[model samples]
Target: MNEMKTDTIETIKRVLAEVRKNPDLAAAMTPSTDIVNDIGLDSLQMITFILSLEDAFSLEIDFETFDFDHLASIAKLSDYIAGRMKEHV
Candidate 1:
């Protein structure tokens, strides 16, 4: 994979680890899980997780350009992050 894809995957893994650290949240997650439906994250938790991801990856997500609800799967999240990082560059 390319550097951006690698970075995106790493970011996703880090975010997953964060979710797994929260005992209440961990039980609901899997690598292929959907953050919203399967994990049952509310809007606040979702924003918090996104912020954590932004910090971890050193990327600024343009909220105006993002459709947050679509960030359900790791692949989608990775793609979004990769796109945002590309915009920053």
Candidate 2:
């Protein structure tokens, strides 16, 4: 994979490690792992997940501008975070 993809995956893993209860699940996470459906984050957990992501990346996620689809999988989240990080840069 490219450097950006590799970096993003690492960031996602770090963020997941902070918020997720299961180390096995976090370790098993791949580009295709669905954050909501596969990980089964309830509404509250999703909030915590988002907060952790924002803190981990030092990002201010504008919920109004967010596309929920980006939260579907680890790949999507990585892409979304990368894009947002670029925008801030």
The candidate scoring highest on lDDT is: 2
lDDT string, candidate 2, 1-89, tens digits: 89988888877876676677766666778889887787777788788888888887899888877888987888888888888999999
After superposing candidate 2 on the true structure, give the runs of residues whose Cα lies further than 4 Å from its correct spot. Answer: none
**lDDT per residue, candidate 1, 1-89, as tens digits?**
67777666656656665754664454444446676666666677677787888788798778798885546676677778777777788
Task: Show pairs that collide, candidate 1.
Answer: none
Predicted structure 2, TM vs. truth? 0.87
What TM-score, computed on C-alpha atoms, does each candidate reach? 0.70, 0.87
C-alpha RMSD for every candidate: 3.4, 1.4
